[model samples]
Target: MSGKVVDDRDQLLGEAVGLRQAGKREEARERLVALSARFPQDAEIAYQTAWVHDTLGLEAEAVPYYERALAGSGLSDDDRRGALLGLGSTYRVLGRYEEAVATLGDAAARFPEDGALKTFLAMALYNTGRAHDAMEILLTLLAATSKAPEIAGYRPAIEEYAKDLDATV
Candidate 1:
């Protein structure tokens, strides 16, 4: 990436993402701020900036930017999905369980193939006292991912939740 032209928007985004991954959050944020200034119409920059804020535990500051990203005219399906999930997570962290459930449920319907979406929805459901629904979703995920070796990564939590749900029933 060193020889690549940083002047390009996507390259800048890549660099920012790389910086974020390298734990240079301040630098990443600076890059995003510069990108936001340079391209006010670029929803991706706003979205990434909001994500950085969210990672820094600034949900209140992130919400408007996520809203802006959602409203931005030319976003692709992936960006739309990211914005939806980010907004839902922010709402969840803010104790808006109903909104989180509604937002994540909509995202799950829109992107049924996204395992992370299902997991997130399950978490929200479980936290909101809908453990049965959470268990059902987790069971479905386990079935779908049975062939993958890393299913074990999520199994314990799923089993614990399932037991809790069973006790509730």
Candidate 2:
């Protein structure tokens, strides 16, 4: 792409982000949808469009854009991660438990250290009737968190919650 086109795209993305940050989500989504149509092959645009839709609670509309973003090449790792997480959460919210589990599992494999991804994966597992697996993941996460000095204070509560979950399972 030409420098001018790149500059314009960047400017538009910035404006959309700014709008969303300013709590004008509907306007941001409208602008992003227009930009996405103009840059149909741009992974960043697709991701932004999907993000706006998802943030607006339009999960059904977000799904296609997230899929497009994931399918496109040249996305940064952060964008790819965001797309996967958004898609997985959207699937979960839509009650597509199997799809949520698969998507979140893939995300967890790719980003093992991302606690949020693991948490969501556990949720998907639990929703799919794999409560034992869900509790295991949560317990492991709690153990890891407890080892960190910054959040050690929460360890007791976490442990208690884990015990409660264990009892239920």
Candidate 3:
């Protein structure tokens, strides 16, 4: 790409991000949508567009953009993680449990230290009738969280989740 084009893309992305941070999600999405069309091959643009849609409760609309972002080769690790997590969560919201399980499982494997990914993976597993596996992951996450003094506040919520999952099983 030309330097000018890159600069323009960066400026547009910054504007969209600024809008989002300003609580103008609709405006951010609109700008991102236009940017996505202008830079169809840009994974960051696709990811940001999808994220705005997802944050706006338009999961169905987010799905295709997330897919495009994931399929693109230019995504950074963090961008890929966001796309995967968003796509998996959107699939879950759409009741595509199998897809959610597969997507979240893959994401969890790629980012094992991310407790939120594991939590979502557990939920997807549970929804897919793999409750035992889900419970195990949650339990492991809880165990890990309990060992961290800095995150002690999360322990209660983790324990409650464990209790709820155990009750279901």
Candidate 4:
């Protein structure tokens, strides 16, 4: 952060983000890499670097950077949420289902209102052969969030079924 004003650092981050959004993923990754070096303690930069690696299909390389970002406390609230989801999703993609479930479960507990986190956690739970648990989460989420007329009308039933799939007829 020394020798760089907050706005300058943010501008660099914005540039990297723009590159990623522009589909110049390699360039974004490069810019984030450099920014990470320049701001070694910057959680957001590390998180961005990790995300770029993930988008590039380099999940393995992204792990340490994600971990580094999460270990630091400099991330804003949204970025912290993203880091948790990113790391957990990366673990799932890497076939580390147990780790994914653990990480995503923690993230979901921390951000109960985050539907995305719950969705990913469901996937991880399924990967670990917790299909019933996964279905429960999915069903509850759907009941709570779906706007389809049919589902909307049956929200209470869906929620009840989500709690006990084996209920009597």
Best by lDDT: 4
**2 versus 3: better lDDT goes to:** 2
Q: Candidate 1 on 43-145: residue-level lDDT in tens? A: 8888988888787788987887787787787678998899889998898888888888998999999999998888888888988998889888888788567
Task: State residue 152's C-alpha deviation in candidate 4, in Å.
Answer: 1.3
Q: Per-residue lDDT of 13-131 in model 3, one digit per residue for the tens?
A: 99998998899999999999999999998889999999999999999999999999998888999889889999998999899999999999999999989898899999998989989
Worst 10 residues of 4 by lDDT: 1-10
Give the per-residue lDDT of model 4 (tens digit) for 57-167: 999999999999999878898999999999999999999999999999999999999999999999999999999999999999999999999999999999999999989
Top TM-score prediction, candidate number: 4
Candidate 4 lDDT at 61 equals 92
Pairs in steric clash, model 2: none
lDDT of 2 at 5: 95
Each model's lDDT: 0.82, 0.90, 0.89, 0.95
* Model 4 residue pairs with clashes: none
Better of 1 and 3 by lDDT: 3
lDDT of 1: 0.82
Angstrom error at residue 3, model 2: 1.5
Instruction: Report the alpha-carbon TM-score of model 3 versus the true structure.
Output: 0.86
Off by over 4 Å in 3: 147-169
User: Clashing pairs in model 1?
Assistant: none
Which residue ranges in model 4 land beyond 4 Å of their true spot? 3-8
